[model samples]
Target: MSYKVIVNATLAKFSASHFLKEPFQCSRLHGHNYYISVEVEASLDENYIVVDFIELKEKIKIIAQSLDHRVLIPELSSDLAISETSESIEVVTNTNKRYVFPKIDVILLPLPATTSELLAKFVHDKIKEIYPNKRITIKLEETKNTIAVYKSN
Candidate 1:
């Protein structure tokens, strides 16, 4: 039988968030260098190889670059009725502070929470968008040990 191997890649989710919901309001308005890893299970065509590491690395880079250095706000989600303008993007937050992405390269992901679980699903969906038919597994980690994994069939 033939076997295949998968790989992992990660990027920092640079954004500020208030950790707790009420009272303490912990999060500290900080950012996380979110790490994202992807695994692709592919049996080599007839050559007994999984896939090209170079090609995979490039693809992963493209996705991470989109989110490398921008202020991530849940208000920037896809589900929100939001719009971007030349001057700035308007976001209504409980803190009532002005948070904006300084550059156009910054990407705002549509997720309910900045937690690991949401991040995993977010990356999985993003990869699926790039490669529609490939069965892939995704792992999103906030730090070295903390992580969330995802798979698509």
Candidate 2:
């Protein structure tokens, strides 16, 4: 039989800013208090548990902390031109809109857009690194009514 372990502690959350390339309203930069929940499914190990709850929570916390209070940049976007200098990063959109942020306040991700679905996948991959071979699911709540879920096959 398969067992599942889920971690959705209060600390597994972050506040960050990001923009999408579609839907005019979302194109404008905005911030959100993002909540993350992770679930790992696996057969029981020697300990008769799928995973340790404390360790899972800690891993999720660390992932959230890395994104806390930062501007997330999708470095792989074709519609965005991103340039980095000694102390700052500049982003120019295909529409000629530009944004400048301090280098220290940015986290460049290998993604095409900073959408909730993609972010959920990103978190799933990070946690998968720590618990390889297990089926993992990640849920990212961008707002009270909007949430995205990603699952590994």
Candidate 3:
């Protein structure tokens, strides 16, 4: 049988901004206090545990820290063109909207969108990179009522 270890510590908090390309209010840049939860599925090891909760939490915390307090930009968005300089990053959208952010304040991700769903997948992938033999489920809460989940099995 397999067991799951869950971690949802308050330390998994990040403040980041993103904008959707859809023609809506969300298209404008906005920030969120995102919360992340991770579930690890594994068979009991010789230690009689699915996985070490402390190790999992620390790994996830590292991922959160990389994105905390920054603007998330989707590097693969065809509708957006990104140019980087030593001091800043320039983003020009297909609609001709332009935004400039300091290089120190941005996190350019290899994703197509910056929505919660995609963020969950990104977290899942990052975890898998560290624990390729384990199954992982990631839940990313964008707001008090909105959450997106991604699973790897």
Candidate 4:
């Protein structure tokens, strides 16, 4: 039999901005203070633990810090064009909406959309990179009432 361990720490928090193209109201730029929760599934080790909680928390913290206080752009979005300079990053949407942000304040992710569900998957993939053999679930809470979950087996 296998066991699972969950790590839900306040440290796993990030404040970031994104926009959704389909929903007109959501297409406007907005930000959220996102909370992340991670669950790891594995058999108990000799220490009688699925994994080291401290180590897992640290790994998630690293991922969260990278996204904190930044604007998340979908690098793979067909309707968006992104360009960068030493001082700033420029984004132009298919509708001719343009935004310029400081280079230090933007994170271009290789995703089609920066929705909560995709964000959960992104975090899950990042964790999987560090724990390739582990089955994992990642939950991203965009707000008090909205959350998205991604699971890998």
Q: Which ten residues in a row have the lowest lDDT in candidate 4?
A: 18-27
Return the clash pairs for model 4, or none: none
Q: Give the TM-score of candidate 1.
A: 0.70
Model 3 TM-score on a 0 to 1 scale: 0.96
List the candidate 2 regions with Cα displacement exceeding 4 Å: none
Backbone collision tally, model 2: 0
Q: lDDT per prediction?
A: 0.59, 0.93, 0.91, 0.91
Superposed model 1: Cα runs more than 4 Å off: 9-28, 75-84, 94-106
For each of the candidates, give the backbone clash count.
5, 0, 0, 0
The positional error of residue 75 in candidate 1, measured at the CA in angstroms, is 4.4
Residue 67, model 3: Cα distance from true site in angstroms: 0.6
Candidate 4 ranges with C-alpha deviation above 4 Å: none
On lDDT, the leading prediction is: 2
Per-residue lDDT of candidate 1, residues 65-132 (tens digit): 66666655554443334357785655544454444444363355666545567667777887778656
Q: State the weakest 10-residue window (summed lDDT) of model 1.
A: 14-23
Question: If scored against the real structure, what TM-score would every candidate get?
Answer: 0.70, 0.97, 0.96, 0.95
lDDT of 2 at 102: 95
